[model samples]
Target: MKAAVKRVPVRNPANALTVLRLVLVPVFAVLTVMSEMTDSSLRIAACVVFGVASLTDFADGWIARTWGLVTAFGKVADPIADKALTGTALVLLSWFAVLPWWVTGLVLARELGVTLIRFWVLRHGVMAASRGGKIKTMLQIAAIAWYLWPFPAGLAGVGPWLMAAAVVVTAVTGLDYVFRALALRRSTRA
Candidate 1:
């Protein structure tokens, strides 16, 4: 006789919010591109949608932890939802020349590389987010938000500067994760 595998529920509030954020990615992307139109309303709408979607990220995490509804689905999907949102925003902004490609490249490289390393070391143990990682996330989100907003000419330099800080934090945190994963893999090998 074979035992059936038990599955974790993927329909929790946290996962639902995570999925909602994912769904909003394309909507956000389209709005961002449309914001390029002559109408200022599109730009404002884009930013508002982005801001609401960003809020869900924090809400999902908080609700999951506070309500004791955390699950493996939330763990995996939440980060992917975040990456999808940030990655698309970065890429789209770069496409429109609002952001420099180099900055987008740096952030994407770090994010993608760290994500790969996370899966590679999954068998060893689960890696927890460090304080630095949290800071990196916040900086990235703030920078992206600033970029999405249609600020005036006087404040043009702010987004790039924030992105520069985000890039630095992202790189540092990525390296930290790599080292942690390697150590975990080493310790588990014995």
Candidate 2:
């Protein structure tokens, strides 16, 4: 007897949201680069767009679960949108001297490292986002948002602390993922 296979379609609301996020990336980047015009108005505009784009990250997942519209495209596009938005923000922030080079480098390294691990694990099977990974994502968004905003003088200091916390969480979760991947590989080997 032949095994039955199920196919998941790509046109889903969640995937649409992911595409929206991807579109926002270049818009945000353009705004950030134009910061010099109108006394940093562009940066503020970029922050607003970036924040709205970030919110879609949560919304898309929620819609996917609520409506049962999850698809492989959503799975892939969502994370790519997240990394592009956050990575672009980090690069822009570093360029503007809002964040140190080392800080951005470490954060970018963690993101890239985890993505590679995910791909490696995918060769065997799928791995969902862990609780720690979610927390790290939240922390990263908060830190980037705070850094972008130009209000509340004292709140400016919060960005660095949030970034630091994010780094710690990112490192721990990344290591956990690597270990899990290794274990999965071993079990498959066995």
Candidate 3:
């Protein structure tokens, strides 16, 4: 006997939100890097855009899971949107000299590498985001948020530390995922 499969449509509210987040990626980067984060108004506007995009990142996933609207597109585009938003901000921040080149490079490398691993293992099976991956995402968001917001001089030093922590989490989770993907790929071959 064959097991029955349920189909989820590609077009849905959840997917729409995911696409919206993707669209916000370039906008957020422009707002962040245009005035070089020096103009207080531009910085604030960038933060608002980043915050809204980040919120949709969570909302779309929640709505999809809760309403059974999950789809292949969501599985792919959602994560892409997330990486685009965070990666763009990190790259732009580094370009503006607000973030260190090493920090941006390390974080983006881990993000892009893990995303590649996901595609690599997709032929074997879909690997859901581990708990550590979720932690890494939240930390990245918080760290990015800290950098975006203009704070008092005394509190400004905390931003880099947060980013450092996020980078650490990103590296750890990225390694974990690579290992899992390799194992899955081997299993499929066996």
TM for every model, in the order presented, reads 0.90, 0.89, 0.92
RMSD of each: 3.2, 2.3, 1.9
> For each candidate, what is the lDDT?
0.86, 0.85, 0.89
Clashing pairs in model 3? none
Write down the worst ten-residue block by lDDT for model 2.
35-44
Candidate 3 regions with alpha-carbon error over 4 angstroms: 1-7
lDDT of 1 by residue, 1-190 (tens): 9998655466888889999999999998899887773346776787777778888998999998888788888998899999999899889888888888998898899888988998899889988888998899889888888877767866856988998899899989999999999999999997
lDDT of 2 by residue, 35-71 (tens): 7423456668988999999999999999998987878
Ranking by lDDT: 3, 1, 2
- lDDT at residue 189 of model 1 (Cα atoms): 97
Please give the lDDT score for candidate 3.
Answer: 0.89
Error of 1 at 63 (Å): 1.2
